[model samples]
Target: MSFKNLLLLCSIIWLGVSCKSEKEDPGPSGPGVPASFGFNSLKVNGAYSGFKYNDVNLKPKVRFTFSAPINNATVANGVTFQSASGEKIAFTSVQEGGDSSVVITPSADLKYLTSYSVTATKALKSKAGGMLLNEVKVELITALDATDKFPVISDEALLTLVQRQTFKYFWDFAHPVSGLARERDSSGDVVTSGGSGFGIMTIPIAIERKFITRAQGLERMQKIVSFLKKAQTFHGAFPHWLNGATGVVVPFSDKDNGADLVETSFLVQGLLTVRQYFNEGNAAETALRADINAIWEAVEWDWFRKNNENVLYWHWSPNFGWDMNHQIRGWNECLVTYALAASSPTHSIDKTVYDNGWAGNSTFRNGNEYYGTTLPLGEPLGGPLFFSHYSFLGLNPTGLTDRFANYFTQNKAHTLINYNYCKANPQQYYGYSDQCWGLTASDIPNGYNANSPSNDKGVITPTAALSAFPYTPTESMKALKFFYYKLGDKLWGEYGFRDAFSLDQLWFADTYLAIDQGPIVVMIENYRSGLPWKLCMSSPEVKTGLKKLGFTSPAL
Candidate 1:
């Protein structure tokens, strides 16, 4: 029991504590300490979870972040990607990111919907000459292959899948703050009024298909209704865009900072549909019905008539009232505005407004022939396919007729004319086949334009054909097969189909818009079961409005 014995015992205890601390710490204790040299994190295609890349033609990349600065020379030899079959993938280059990360780019485009693995070998060394303790690997799965042979599917199943997936844009990827649909994929924090209306119409479809639970759907509907109750409004009409978080008006254009009658009509269409769907006896359902009713009743539709004029104006800004004085007219997508105006219980418009303003002061009639098919309404070649789609979404077109024309025949003719126009290939666009023809207002490589034969730009919007399913099921089925089976990887995405594509320009969009995505679901549901149309028509207000407008339908 000497002093030397005590000092030796103390030294042994200190060594034991030091070793335990070093072993427990996952990270390096100091710069010179030997540490695990492999990646602390790995990102395949920039995500930990498997992601469906939008562009099938683009090569996939792998990135790794190491615990310590990696040796520059070891990166090329230590990192590699291989297919599931164990074949090595050729890399075009390996580039360093700062001192701690490396990115591997593939030599060619990765196969679509295929699984691949990225590996970092133990040979990967830190700048301090320490080798990785173990090899690390991760998996990445590409999205569906568009060029694969077509698979057999029932028409009913295909339509249901399309509707459900499109509904996800509004339900799953809704704006975080407002619980509303975004104006488009790239539009941050900007929620759309009309597009959200289209989205709202699809909620029942989602619930019926079990894409979402009824409770989930109702919760989201509550969020949307609450936001609407607090959001800025002009004469009870919402603007085209709003800040998703604040519910404040987001100016669509320089002067379009106030009421939008057409957009409001679109919103009300969905709201009324929701009101019809949730008219149950449950307390939550009752509350939802009342909220929707309040929103529907508050819209001052008569105020948009511009001081008792026989026309309803499209927009009215508080800062510049009536400066952007575009009138709502027909043979276009604004027919719903007139119908809703007449249908409004609290603020209804007279039938004369429909006769004068919507019918283009009696110049709305257009009976024309294109490609051996007679278009019963609108200008030549039917003036884009959306005219048939937007209004007819909730307003059942089957056996729907007015003094103007038989809507079913008119819409069918319009879709057929658009299809035949592409089949004829008058412009000789690259991919204009019977199964690949739909021209509408959508994004183009140069910019956005409404595509038609008369105003023909080669941009083909998938929503155009898909939304026309009710009017032209046989032709629409052909287009659906082409879009889903042939061009799916390029055209479709997580939520649904991208905004538009141009085969002539060899361009494809990697975005989705609320306006385009909403109709695909609501109209497809309409085509499949006539659910949305039937529900909207069930409303007493809608029946009264149609009767006042002198319109007749089988449902009516």
Candidate 2:
């Protein structure tokens, strides 16, 4: 019981007390440690942001990783999901995320285009008994799937959905470097001038539909105009193709490295439409409008007149100088080239170019009768419907006429001829009926062709029919239903319809082209509300050019 014994006993008791306190009252991990018991990362359907479920057959899986190892009880009780309406969503299982994460698999396929909310509650605890510093909530939206039960959508609703989804190809999937439309899904860095033109016309549509805000659309427009300013040009015209990233000329062929007049005209058409659209006096909009106008005025349309000859050539390569040797004739998609050239204020063409060159020296007239319909200004069967579509996309066909024919009737007759030709089905293609009939320049089993009854290769380009919606709605609607509801499995994708489908070859395009997809959205909007035509025609230059060309419109 001496002083040594007392001191030793006291030391042992104090040491025991300190050790117990250390074990029982573990404080915060440290200042450097993250405060939340929630995940450092979270992925819904395998994407962190803008996750989309394209395949209707697949269920959605959400995976998350925590800052610290989470408790098993927290995993069981803390994670929950509700739809935008607060209705609970059942999950098949909550599994471990291997080391420090968790996975939740939905019990059923998520509804298309539906928004869902996922919540990790404050009850979620770390392995060390620390509660979640803040509850983690994620909002995700499911994309519209083709397999979803068909709701009774109005015709307008159907058209809007088709237009918006197709527009996404130009917006969401645009070229990473230049923000221009890619030539096709497979053409990695290649961008098309004509197709990009068609895409430009859809930007205003996107703004009107609220797919993007005016600021977002203007930002993209500025990028495009800025790129065009620095991009390669031949004779003040853009090439048929350009490298999307570096703004270099992408030779479409060995000799096609220079100015492409027809393609440039298409691009100018879109630029004018954009100029008309962003008319507000805001700094961003004013800058965009000025850039577009500068690009438009720079094109020397008269230079393409070929030594002031009657005919205008399609290409003028710096490497080969018109060696492609193609003429800008009518009864084809190049009508826009002539119209825009004649419309150009700075570099204008005389009406004689339209008359002798485009009208084939007054022989461009198509007096041929097919399927009891007469086309006034194109080859047999109106040369595959696009003759009616491409030019009229911005130029309102209603009340539009020259000396030869009324454009509206010409287009309608062309569509009916194409439709009737398919109904006749002389070639006995695998799928040609009232519900599926359109032949134009599109991919076939062999390759691309300008398909028509006379040139029937059994390929059906949906754009040939879809773009004709402005001309023939009833027939186009039939084709639309067949293409969407019946053939959605094969033809539809994350974007809307693929470029073309051939039943005879049992072939379907697994790709999309900017040219084909662009027309669908712009032309459909034109049919519904005349938005593009209104915007394009609003330009004073367009009015003057149309007058010079002897064109008249009731809308004017």
Candidate 3:
């Protein structure tokens, strides 16, 4: 069985502290009023028949009050939460010596989509030594917490479930030996440098969310950093792909068999944010931080400039040096490339490189309006939604500014345009709605394509909308509900929402991509809690680079 299934199975063991049913507090206007109720049994919610099948998350805490004070000592033997088959479900109870109410929480989360009964027998005693006349019971069914089923999982529950499941793509499915994230679910040993970086960013969230223990996260991180220390690099930059088990280069294409500077920057972005998160100065975390710093300081950002040119080149091949000759520039996902480039402590690029290469000197800038939204940069309709995502995953875009733009403003405009285009449905796709919209690079029926207003593929990637939670909450939440509640049976899966779906062709992906999955977890959290943004922006290196590149922000 998978590790996730094993954890679920562990929750069913019979070691629960045991708890019972509940009752509502009998009362009058204030004090000095006599309470009217026969203390026959626990008056659970004021009705003895039993509660309607109330729904909650698996490990819900059920609280009930009584007409009189509860006998704390008698609770353990007097109450029991059990399954239909009479299997006793263990729980821990909380009540003070004279407290009128008791709260019970399952020792472990209850089975997803299962039913259980909380019963209080006449054996329950009141603090005044009064006994119950009969038994009382309450019924509850767990919320649909698994992908195999469906229920009205909305709001915070939906957000939490999405984060947990999408996180599994990195934690549960990561490469076994190297702990690296693969390019796609089926990529096997071909781990990706950029996506692995994204995966690294998610680990601290997993730890904070209690998805994994701190030691587990540390172990996984240690494995990844250790592998990168030994992995093949061109001038201290990791290649786009590497053999997870052997730390060898795996060419993207023949000419691309070398260090991919853009990908390396992405990897470094995740690493730097994570390094800040583990700043408690403990031995393990300290070692990890030092190792990450070594990797960060060693990148030859200046050398990637192709003989001191203003532009940063994307690839550097040991055997085919500068053969790819790809320059990192403007209004795309590579802004992170330049940000990290300028942020490097050792071999740092000049601020002029960013100005002359990424902006100011570049002509890709477009200030035109599309779909009633004016984009500050990138292709019309803001290229793919990922251009808004990739850089800002760690780098806080909100309130961030350079001479060029206020990043949050730029990103928000970009997202609305993408969202509006899908709503426009120029090509008339099947599932384009206010509640079902998002487009970006994802698997299309005909292969992979970057779906956007300009490159329409009738495909919708959940990440495109879901990751924009911080930029557009109401719309993103609508898209999330539509993906999980409406199209969930096919759209949701073991790892999370499947990679992408295209209803126009009656197609849906059963795949997950590292680059796509990471942002969903990080950005949703960036919306709920600015953890990544806070950590990334706090990096002195990032601050130095942003300042050198003529940026300013409250965070700075």
Candidate 4:
């Protein structure tokens, strides 16, 4: 047979397609050779054997084909899989047809990034009760193949692997001009304030994980801060976007051209943590803190209050002031807006602005129960899962409590509600399961939309569940495995897990969003080391803000 055809045949055999090569033709034996006595191995021999197969699946299916019908009783004694380390692997052998090839599947995940061999001994007998004349083996190595598979690693190792890869979005692909994260993989010069804010939080995570040297991360931070210093602002508040190349306004909408207090607040959330993080006595750290302070203190949080009314506005344009007129409402992803506005050392807002403006809305409080989990705040089913992620990335909800809700309780309940709903899967989506869920804003087959229980689309956003690592470790880890080991070929890529995927529609988004990607790195770090939380919370101003808002932090 041609080498190409031989390789194709080997692949078919591995997939459990029954085969009897033309060379061995089970139909009849040579004049002197018995059809049931001599047989070649199902796996491709020498050419592919000397070099370890890099595409071997961790949970491999090995097939053993024969020239003639096999003696079922002797199959078990004849076929075995063994690790190079002398470990005997357990597997189940199946023969779909009485005389077909035997397909062996390991009972558990194999040690990835390592070599192993599958062997069929000569003791095996055929239907004619004659011993097989040759022994056959297949050698392989389990290597990561993002196109269709992933490696199996320890939970801690997986967490580290995930954190490091996610950091690549904020690092390798960050906008060249501003050194800030792009809105998405496709976004070029249009840089987002909110997404950049989330990206800032990942700097420390990358540093702590050793993905980048501290000096390298510090250099990036310097570039980010320098760009922000020159970026256009209205009343000291940054717009929702800035042209990365010129530090000019890139209006989110025609009316949203000037100041975006909510986005600025999100930006400040990361700034404060960074200000707290690089507290070493080094001159560079000292200068970074000073630059961060200049940006932080300059934001007129109270200016967004629109003549000091007790609530914060979302946007204000020099061209169309307050035309957007969106309020920074809560029980949403804007809690950090209020938290940082209240925390600002120079342009701080009164707590009443938070209470009357953010929590004052009718939808601000939801004591309702969904999927047996009572939500302290938010729309039924807890709105899109990001409501718990964005703000809390730096807010540290572990022991944070306020009049409206116990921040930790609220966030965890929100995650669980989202989790249980996906588990119940009343929508009956193709891939909904306990280990495969996470709904939030992402690219859908039709376009982008906020996915939640209320708006149950048959889509799963990896960041939703994976970012909830701190709130729902067990549940999140299960989803992590499902993404990494099962759907990894389609979901994981250059920037870690891609934006979103829909199995029923056979649609997988090959994009990454800064807001979504940042949380995966920061939250996973928070889950493992509490680095971001501890750094953000260490700021005296953050503690002051939480306290003024009538919240008590046991950790504080």
RMSD of each: 18.2, 21.4, 19.7, 12.6
TM-score of 3: 0.73
lDDT of 3 by residue, 1-556 (tens): 6343455345323111112222243323345444322222232333332343433567766665555677888888878889766889998888743577777778987875456888766667777665653455667665444352477855998898999999998988999999999899999899999998888999888888889998998889899999889988888999999999999999999989998988898899999988998887789999999999999988999999998999999888888888877788888888888888888888888888988888854456778999898888777678899999998998898889988888999999999998888887776655587887888999988699988887887789999999999999999998998788767877898889988987654567988999999999999999998999999999998999888888999988
Q: Residue 220 error for model 4, in Å?
A: 0.9
Q: Which stretches of candidate 3 lie over 4 Å from their true place?
A: 1-149
Assess every candidate by TM-score. 0.74, 0.73, 0.73, 0.74
Please, what are the lDDT tens digits per residue for candidate 2 over residues 334-417?
Answer: 777888888887999999888889886454787878889887877766777667777777888888888878988988998899
lDDT of each: 0.82, 0.80, 0.82, 0.82
Clashing pairs in 1: none
Model 4 misplaced stretches (Cα beyond 4 Å): 1-148
lDDT of model 3 at position 479: 90
Clashing pairs in 2: none
| Model 4 error, position 4 (Å) | 46
Worst 10 residues of 2 by lDDT: 49-58
lDDT of 1 by residue, 1-556 (tens): 5343466467556544644553455455476776654445556667643222223334767777766778878877787778777888887545556677777777888776455777778888888777765576766655445464547688788887788788889988899888889998888899999999998888988898889888888998999999999999999999999999999999989999898888888889988989898888999999989888888889899998888899999999999999998988777888888888899889999999998888865546777689999887788788878888888778888888898889889889988999999899776555688988899989888688888878887889999999998888888899999888888757778887898987655578888989899989988888888899999989899989998999998788
Q: After superposition, how far is residue 16 of candidate 4 from its true place, in Å?
A: 40
User: For residues 84-197, what per-residue lDDT tens digits would candidate 4 score against the true structure?
Assistant: 777999988777455757777788988644568888787787777666655767776664433426668899999989988888998999999899888889878888998899
